[model samples]
Target: MKEESSVSRLQIMSVMGLSKQRNYLLTQYLQAIQLPRGFGGDLVFEFQVSQGRVRHLVLDEQASSLKEQTVMELIRRSLLAWLPEESRSNR
Candidate 1:
């Protein structure tokens, strides 16, 4: 049906928009962490979307000896701080 197709199109557009926003935010976070005191080694983040939910992995080559929970908590706080006020509120 035309209505169903329109709804599907809208959903696809929304997903794509979210993907773009996520990528931009990730890039900004990466840039912000380039400082020596932030993240010294190669840092990579992988994002996967499934069933409208987004999951992320942060790999820091320099994080050896650091507790996983600690690293994740730091990254989460840093990324949240990097996000816009509106985006932070939405989360």
Candidate 2:
């Protein structure tokens, strides 16, 4: 399992290299998962579906830096705040 801090909004966007067409899909399902302990930071949840079965997994974020975690939180909040504006403009 990987740490949640190992991944970021910018990193996912970088990995997927989503175009304008797919950007809406990402924004549509933006989510946040927290660790069961509910002590420090967020957790990462991953789901996979195949020809056989689907699996659910949660990632840890124990050693993440304060700066590392906050940046993503800030970005997430900013995106959430901007979503309404984006929708209106897209119409």
Residue-level lDDT of model 2, residues 1-91, one tens digit each, is 7766433322232313334544554455353322122233333424332222223322334533333554445544433433333344666
Off by over 4 Å in 1: 1-18, 37-40, 44-76, 80-91
lDDT for model 1, please.
0.43
Q: How accurate locally is residue 61 in candidate 1, as Cα lDDT from 0 to 100?
A: 46
Model 1 lDDT at residue 91 = 69
Residue 52's lDDT within candidate 2 is 21
Candidate with top lDDT is 1
User: Which residue pairs collide in model 2, if any?
Assistant: none
lDDT against the true structure, per candidate, is: 0.43, 0.37
Per-residue CA lDDT of model 1 for 6-56, tens digit only, reads 211001112243556665555555455422233222234444544334456
Model 1: how far residue 63 lies from native, Å: 10
